[model samples]
Target: MTSTRRRGLIDIEIDAQKEKVRKIKEDNRIFDTLETDKTTLDNEKKKWFFTRWFSPTSIDDLEKRIARKEQKIKEGLERTSIDKIHELEERIRILELAKTNRCENVVWMDVPEILDKKIQDDYLEKFRKLPQKIDEQVQSVNITMFGGVGVGKSSFLNTVVTALINNPQRIYRDYKTAPSTTGISKTKAFIPEEIRKKRGQSYREHPTFKDVMHCIVFVIPATTNLYDRDDEALNKIRNLQQRINGPRDVKQVAIVTNIDRIGVPNVDMESVFKYPNVKEFCEDVSKVLEIEIQSVYPIANYHEEQKPTAAKNALALMALWDMFKCGERHIKKKLEIGLNDDQ
Candidate 1:
C-alpha cells in the first residue's frame, strides 16, 4: 500500500511542471506581437511628418512661379485701362498732325550762297507754294537784335530778305556799324507783299506790324550796352511786342552781333544780366516781346573786306546758324497751332 501512494505523488508533480511550461510559451508569443505592432506605428508617423513639413521643390523655384503670376496679372490690368488707351491715341494724333504740317522755314545748304542751285531749288519748291502752306499753317517768329549803335540791323534785314528771295544760303555774312546816336532797329518780316502794301509805309506797318506776324529776327549790336536803362533799347522791344497781332502769334530768336566787342570792360555779353536793373528790364521786355526768348547767338558781323579765313570764326558762324534754325522750327510749330485754330 505504501509503494502505490508514492507513485501517485510523482505523477501529480509531473503534470504541474507541464502546465507551467505551456504558460511561459504563450506569454513570449504575446510580447513578440506587441513589439511588431509598435514598430509599424512608428514608421507610419515618420512618413506623415516628412510629407507635411518638407517640400520637394526648392525655395527659389517657388518664388519664381509666384513672381511670374504677379507679372501676368499686372499686364492684364494695364491692357484693360481705357484711360491709358485714350491718352496714347490722343498723343499719336497730335504727333501725326504735327508731322503732316511741318514747315520748312530754314533750309539746310552745303554752301552759304543764295545762288547755290540746290538751295534755290529747295527755296522755289517751298516758296512758290507759300500761299498754300500759309493757308494750311501760318508760322510765327520773334526776333531780337543786340548790339551797340551801328551793328548793322537794317543791313542784316536786307541780306535776310535777299536770301529769302533766292535761298537762305544768301544770308549776309557782313554787317556795318551804325552811328552811336541811333539805336539798333528790330523788325518783323512777313510774307505776302499784299499784306505789307496794305499796312502802309511805316516800320510799324512791316508785315510783322500786325499782332499776327509770322517771323521774328533779333539783331544784336556790335558794342552796345544791351542792359542800359536808356529808352532806345527798351523802345525797340516795346515796338516788337506791339506788332504781334495776338499773344500767341510770336516766336523769338536772338542775334548777337559784333562779337569782337563782346569782352570789353563793362560790356560782357555773358554778364549782360548782371547790369543794374537789367533783370527787371529784360522781364518787362519779354512781356512785350511777343515770344519767349531762349538764348543769344554771337556773330562776328565782319565786313567783306575785314573778313578773315579763321576756321574758328567760320565754325562759330555755322553754330549760330544751326541754333537759329532750331529756334525757327519751334516758332513754326507755334504758328501751326494758330493756323489749325483758324482752319
Candidate 2:
C-alpha cells in the first residue's frame, strides 16, 4: 500500500483500537469493584464484621446483581478485541521505517541489558556450562517458567542452551538425561549451581548469577485464546509467582510458545510474521500479563528441530534478548535512569 493510504488506514484503526481498549479497562474496573463488594458481603454473612442481623431480601438482591455483573465482566474480557493492538503495531512498524532509512538511525544492542561486561565476557572463557560441569565459571540467570503445564517450557530452555554452547550434542544429550530436567521442569528452570571449579589456567569464578537470580519467563500456549484467559491466564501466573515468593520486581518476559500451532493452517517456525494474528497474540498477551509489549515474544521451541534449525535458533535468541531487556529495565529503574527504545 502507498504511504498515503497506509497513513489514513492507521488513523482509523487507531481510533477503533482506542475505543475498544477503553471499554476493556472500564470492564476490568467494574469487576474489581464487584469483587470487593462480594468480599464485604462474605464478611458480613460470616458475622466477622460484628453484624449479627442481616436482611435476607437485601442479601439475595445484592448477591444476584453481583453474580450477573461478574459474568458480564468476564465475557467482556474474553471478548476483548486485538484489532486496536494490530493497528498500533502497523503504525509502529511504519514509523520505524523512518528510523531505519538507509540504516543510519537504526539502533541495536549486543549484550543483554542486565549483564555486566566482565560477567558476560565469561562466555568467552567458560564456553558453556554443563549440568555436571561444576568447574566452569559462567554467568547465570534464574528463569522461572510460568504457563499452564507442558507449554514447551522445557523445550524452549533446551533450545537456548543448545544455541549458546560450543558443543550442541552435549546439551542435547543432557536434555535427554533425567538430571538435565534441572535446566527446565514444569515448576522451574535454572543454570544448575553445581559450581564450575576450574578454568583454562586459573580457577573459574561465578560472580553474577547470585545477584540477578529469578528471571521470569511467562509462557502462553498457541492452543488457548490469547486474550480470553478466563480460567487460564496471567492471574494464574501471578498467583504462582506469589506462591513462589520470589522478589516482587524480578525482570520478566512473556513467551508465546507453540507458535506452530496457532490458528494458521500453515504454521511453521519460519513463518511467524506472515501470520498477523501471531503479532496480535504477542501484544495481547503482554497487556494481559501487564508487561511491556516489547517484552512479549512468540517463538517455536526445539520440539521439532532434531539438529536445530536456523529459524528456531533466531527465534530463541530474540526471545532471550527480550528477557534480558526485562532484566535491563529493572536495572535502569534502580539507577533512576530512564530506558531507551532499543531495550
Candidate 3:
C-alpha cells in the first residue's frame, strides 16, 4: 500500500472518531435535560394537596412523562459508557499523533489585536482595585497551582505578573510570590505531600478562610501524554484535588500550558484556541482532572520571548481573570455561609 493511501485512511479514522465523540456529547446533553425535566415534574407532583386534587389527571400524566424520561435516561446511560468515550478518545489521540497537523480549528476565541490592550487594561484595572473591594475578613486571596514538574507552573505565574503589570521592561524576578498589589498570592512551586498534608490538617482544625487557598489551579502541559508522566505524580494531583476542593469548597480551574508545543502550523499564543488539538488537549486534561471543559484554559507561557507580546499577555491575563473570579467566589461563599450561621 502507498504511504499516501495509508495516510488518507488514518485521516478518515480520526474524523470518524471525532464525530463519534461529538454525538456522544450531544446524547449526554439530551439525557441531562431529560433528567432535569423529570426532577422538576416529580417536585411538582409532590407539592401541595391542592395540586393533586384539582388536577389528578394532569398529575398522573406528569408522572407518566417522568417515568418515560427515566427509562430514556437509563437507556442513554447504558449506551453511553464513560469507558467507551475514553477508548474512542484514546484512539483519536493515537491517530492524531501518527500524523502531523491532523486536526483543524474546532474551536474559536475572539482575539483581535485591537481588543488586546482593552482586555489587558480591563483585567489589570480590576486586579488593581480588587484588593480594596474584597472583604476584610478574607484578608488576601491565594491561588495554589498543582502539577507535575516542568509543566510551566512558574512560567505561567511569571507571564501573568508581567501582563498584569503591563510592562515589557519591568522584570519579575521572584517566581515564589506575585506582587502584593495584584491582590493575588501564588504558591512558589508544587507543594510536597508532607507540606500539603500539614496544611490540610491545620485547615481542618482552624477552619479559617485567612491564609487558605481560595482557587486551585492545575497546570498540565499540552504535550504531556498520559502514559509518559509518572503515575505517582498524577495520583498525587488527583488526591490533592479531592482533598482540597472536595472538603474546602475551593473553586478549581485547570491551566493547560505549553500549547505552542502542539503540532500547529505557524501557531501564535493568541491562536491557541483556533487549533482543534488544543481544544482536545484541554478536554483531555479536563477529563483527567475531573474539571469542566469551560474551566480549562489553554495558554502559552513566555519561555523564548525576551519580552511579552500583547497576545501572550492577553492570554495570560485572561486565565488570571478566571483564577481571580474563582478565588473571589470562594471567599464570598464562605462569608455568606458565616453570615447565615450567625442569623
Candidate 4:
C-alpha cells in the first residue's frame, strides 16, 4: 500500500481509539459514582438503627445498579472486535513487509528540463492568473502559512514569490524570518504587515473573500518528530486551523521544508520522492495536520542558494499551483454556498 493511504488508515485508527478511550473514561466515572452510592447504602444497612432496617430495599436497589454497571464495564473492556483484529494483523504485515522492501515513491512527476521555458512559464502564468479568474469578490488569493517557530514558513514563501516573479535581483519585501540565536517567529498576524499596509484594512475586520485567506499552508520541518512536538504549539495549530480554515471552509495543505536536510538520496532534489525518509516525513505531517497525504508537498527552499534551479523552481511552482487551485475553489464554493443560503 502507498504511504499516503497507510497513513490515512493509521490516522483514522488513532482518532477512533481516542474516542473509544473517552467514552470508556466517561463510563468509568459513572461507574465509580454508582459504586460510591452502593458503598454508602451498605454502610447505612450495617448501622444498628431503625433506619438500617427500613433502608434494606434501598441497599438492594443500589446493589442491582452496581451489578449492571459492572457488566457494562466488562463489555466495554472486551472491545477487540473482528475488524480491529484484522486491522492489527494488516498493520503487522505492512511493518514486516517494510523491513525488507524500500518505500515506493508516493508523488511522481517529470522534472521540467532546464531549457523548457515554455512549460515553466505556463506554470507561473497559471498560478498568476488564478485569482483573476476566480470570483469577482476575490481579486487576490490570500494564502496563510503557519506552523512551529522555525519550520521554514518564511523561507518557503520567499521561494514561491521568487519563482513566481522569476527574478532574483528584484528586491521584494520579505517576511521576517527566525533569527539563528532564538528561532522565534515575528509573524503575529495571518496577513503580513506589507500586504495589510497596502490594503489599509485588517482581514479580521473585513471578513470578505478579498481580504480573508483562501488557503492555509501549514509548514513543518522535515526532521520534526510529531511524537515529541510541543503540546501547546500543536494545540495552537489545531485551534488556528479550526478558527480560520474550518469556519470559512478554506482548503488546507502542508509543506514539509528542509527536504535537503533529510538526506534526499545522494543530495538530489529530483529524488526527493524516492527517498523513504521524505515520504515518511510527509506522511507524519499529513496525519498530524489531518490533511490528505497528497496535499502534503515536500520541497527544499532557496535558503542559501543565490539563484534558482529548474528542480527547485518546479517544486515551488507545483506547490504554488496547488495553492492557487485550492484558493480558487474556496472562492467559488464560498460564493455558491452563500448564494444558496440567501435563496
Task: Pick the TM-score winner.
Answer: 3
Per-residue lDDT tens digits for candidate 4, residues 220-314, read: 77777677656655666677776654356778888888876665421245435555777777888778888888788887787656566555666
Highest-scoring model, lDDT: 3
Off by over 4 Å in 3: 1-105, 108-115, 129-133, 170-186, 196-207, 227-230, 264-267, 339-343
Determine the C-alpha RMSD for candidate 1 after optimal superposition of all C-alphas: 37.3
User: What residue pairs clash in candidate 2, if any at all?
Assistant: 134-195, 134-196, 134-197, 135-196, 135-197, 136-196
Assess every candidate by TM-score: 0.34, 0.44, 0.60, 0.55
**Prediction 2 global C-alpha lDDT:** 0.54
lDDT of 2 by residue, 1-343 (tens): 6455223222444466566656666665765678787886786667633665776666677688788887886775544346755665565554333222222222222422122223333442333342342213323344566666677777777766665542434445344443552343333542222224335442235334334334678777866665564655555776655643433467768888876665422113343443556666776777766777777776766654447544555566667756654554455453354323222
Worst 10 residues of 1 by lDDT: 264-273
Minimal lDDT window, size 10, model 2: 98-107
Worst 10 residues of 4 by lDDT: 178-187
Rank the candidate models, highest lDDT first: 3, 4, 2, 1
Write the residue-wise lDDT of candidate 1 on 109-163 in tens digits.
Answer: 2423122234334543443443322222333223444323565565555443333
Candidate 4 deviates by what RMSD? Answer: 22.0
For every candidate, C-alpha RMSD to the true structure in Å: 37.3, 22.9, 26.4, 22.0
- For candidate 1, the clash count comes to 25
Instruction: Name the runs in model 4 displaced over 4 angstroms.
Output: 1-122, 128-133, 167-203, 229-231, 245-247, 265-267, 339-343
